[model samples]
Target: MNPASPIRIQGIHYTLPEKQVGLEQLSAEGRLLSTPETMRDFGFGDCRVSSVPATVLASATVKALLERHGVEPGEVGLLINASVLPTSSLVPRGEALAEFPSGESAHLGLFRFSSTRIQDELGLINARTVGLSELGCVSLSHAVWLAHAVMLMEDLKYAVCVNADVFPDGIKREVVYNVCSDSACAVLLSRNPEGMHLKRYHTLTRGYYWDPDGHQNELLAAYFPTGKRVLEKTFKESGLAREDIKLLVPHNVSLRSWEILSRFTGIPLEKIYTENIRPKGHSVAADNWINLKDVIDRGLVSKGDHVMMFSFGLGAHWGCSIVQV
Candidate 1:
């Protein structure tokens, strides 16, 4: 395999609102789509839900990230919004958006353009805005991939990768099996290596599950087989074997799925971090990175240790990123 990319994750920050809901609470409230027992079997737990929209959550974290690193908004070369469930934005963030009202004009359907909104709201005047949709939970890491490519191609310095999610009212927090949570995360990427070393990113998708909202059965059937193939390829491309990886940073999905996946990928279950499965549930795009920060903080992934982050989006996107700490 070739040498890995030199891009670095300068800083990663995520935010979850104060509101929390437990599985039992949801069960009692009759808001869970799946029965409490089934959800618990998959990996039931409580999660933080935000009252604000997803865009607001994303913008708040991005602003905080800029302040934490002492980076000016003008220094941001690209702002990539990678969110699956973007809550509706009632107000326009830009001057041009005023021309089109909510129900008038052909601008946006219902979901807002969070990239430009964040840019305009935060005065990221010089930063070009972009978004990655339909990738579901995979879009977050894919944003890293896109950022790496853009910076390398455009000779840019700093790229802001943002992800956020919000489930509407009356919607079930559990999908398929993994529980859902509202959260936002921001990752500052740079060509300069001063922080988390981003080694390689690999992704695979099955279009058969493109419209999986009504086709949950087929999506479930395709998860393991397709996910295993991509994960094997991800490990291969990173030049790391099963035993070479010290840890597998997983998205906050189901423990049962990871149990079966360990047998397929040959990575032991002990290496897979699952402590957050109950605490945060599946934090959509924030899961892998959140788990990553936690494990690194606890000395689970040490210096020079090889680690892999794996995630499967609802739209049948399976991918992983292999990093050397």
Candidate 2:
């Protein structure tokens, strides 16, 4: 994609659940597999727990993005749901595991499509809906790339990429030493060359590590090297050096891991935006987008500055994108 006419981010909006649970509370309730001390050492202070369903959060995010940017719902030409968890599996966090099997039949769950529901509820009549999964934390990055490609091919003017995920009831919030949170983010992409410009992006998936539980150790071993490779490729393709990147918008995972990655990629640790790590925790694919929005909102980067976003997904996926603001 040409940088001159790149896919621009018009607006970004993210919604977190009202309830905030501290690490100690989750540990006490047995909802977190790791100890509270371990999680706190890993840089997680608290995470948001959704009392409502994921679909409601997703819809509200998209609606807020449109309203904040003064864009009508009818003007959105593409809508991509990039949630890590399937819509069928995303029920209210407060619901019990046993009640889920009896409350909603398999048929009903199978037909619960978040993309279409958001479109219908938000009145995105002209938007083409698509749902993406399996990429795990990289799902939203893939959605952004897909939206950009589809818009260029179809001559669409506006595209909305929304991602939302919640841990099913009775499931542990700790994953590979990182705390998880329930949240949704919506990013509006336009062809009018405004906001952040999508300069270059790269993604890699290693199917050999598909079984997260079975290959947890191996996945952890490969995370840093694979993530470094993706970041290097993104910088190389964007024709910029690590020093040129004004900010590194990262997925809200372990701050220690990011510190190691910064050393591996030769990017200074101070360049990374880590303010959200403790407060927001990891909201799956929504982390990078949420952080990016906050970075822009706080004036962390000036116009024409290069920003790099990177994330490692549980399904053994590595994704990196360099954008110009």
Candidate 3:
């Protein structure tokens, strides 16, 4: 039997506009979410939009992914946009070949690529969309798993996984105050060896609730675990113990969840990078790529290191994938 095609993360890039963060970057502007005055004072307006559109983010990330590995967009067999926000026409946008096209009005919609319409417009034959409403935080790794499955079961060569999510406007500061932030992440996944290859994939979900009366409760119930039993079941199912993971990127719901996971996994506090305290904040679905991007860009890992990822969404869903760098 032929072996599975090795899945590698070729290149990773992200854009966080400087002008985007108004008061959030200021020291004096800091305040707790419980205060309505602070919420009003801060410009946590409707979700943030990139200086570029959703497709721009996808295109830029794809371009970087290709250029870094000396590959071309045309060479990519599949393009998957797990982005919560897709272009208006829902068409493939990479065909434009330019980041910002000024005089291209009529062909604007043609270049946009929407994963939802991949199988219909193109003879993708097996293309499918994983909507953010259904995917939540686990979308990127889920796409990786699907692409791996396709490569193993089919004869596909390459797949591009793009994740772009913008926090919508009018979100109560108190709502996602601790754990949510705005950001975009894109990754090109393929069977190439220059990039880190996937060795195994594991997923676990444990039910968690914010109960004040239970003596271990605080914060609002922003999200719930998909299934109670599934959360603690990953350690044994993944075929490796928690100590085997050199790095872990989980959904950074809040400080409380971090503490809960640290206790549950028995991993060190320093190994977790999702507890972000900065202008970037906690990016939802983009957490995995963003964290991995930092690791790759900073030259933090060796060739044989293993990176474990955990993603949980609002649907009470959780996903985990182990990559060997």
- RMSD (Cα, Å) for all candidates, in order, is 3.5, 2.2, 7.6
- State every prediction's TM-score relative to the real structure: 0.91, 0.94, 0.70
True-vs-predicted CA distance for residue 25, candidate 2, Å: 0.8
Best by lDDT: 2
Q: Report, for every candidate in turn, its global Cα lDDT versus the true structure.
A: 0.81, 0.85, 0.54
Per-residue lDDT tens digits for candidate 3, residues 1-325, read 1224566666677755443443333223332344433433332322233444454554555556667766654556666667543332244344431232335564665454445453343344443444333455677777666766765666566676767654433332233444245555667677677777776666543344322235223213433333222434554555667677777765544545555566655666578765343345556677777877787667766677777776665434567667777
Off by over 4 Å in 1: 1-4, 86-112
List clashing residue pairs in candidate 2: none
Displacement of the residue 322 alpha carbon in candidate 1, Å: 0.4
Tens-digit lDDT string for candidate 2 (1-325)? 6666656887789999978999989888788887899889888999999876777788998999999888999999999998787642334333532123335475565655778989999999999999888889998889998999998889888999999887776778888899999998988999666577888888899998899999988888888888888888887788889778899999999998988988887788899999899999999999999998899889998889988999889878988998888
Cα-lDDT of candidate 1: 0.81
Between candidates 1 and 2, the lDDT winner: 2
Worst 10 residues of 3 by lDDT: 210-219
Tens digits of per-residue lDDT for model 1, 52-159: 777788899999998999899999999998887634232344433122244554465444577888999999998998877788888889998888888877978899
RMSD of 2: 2.2
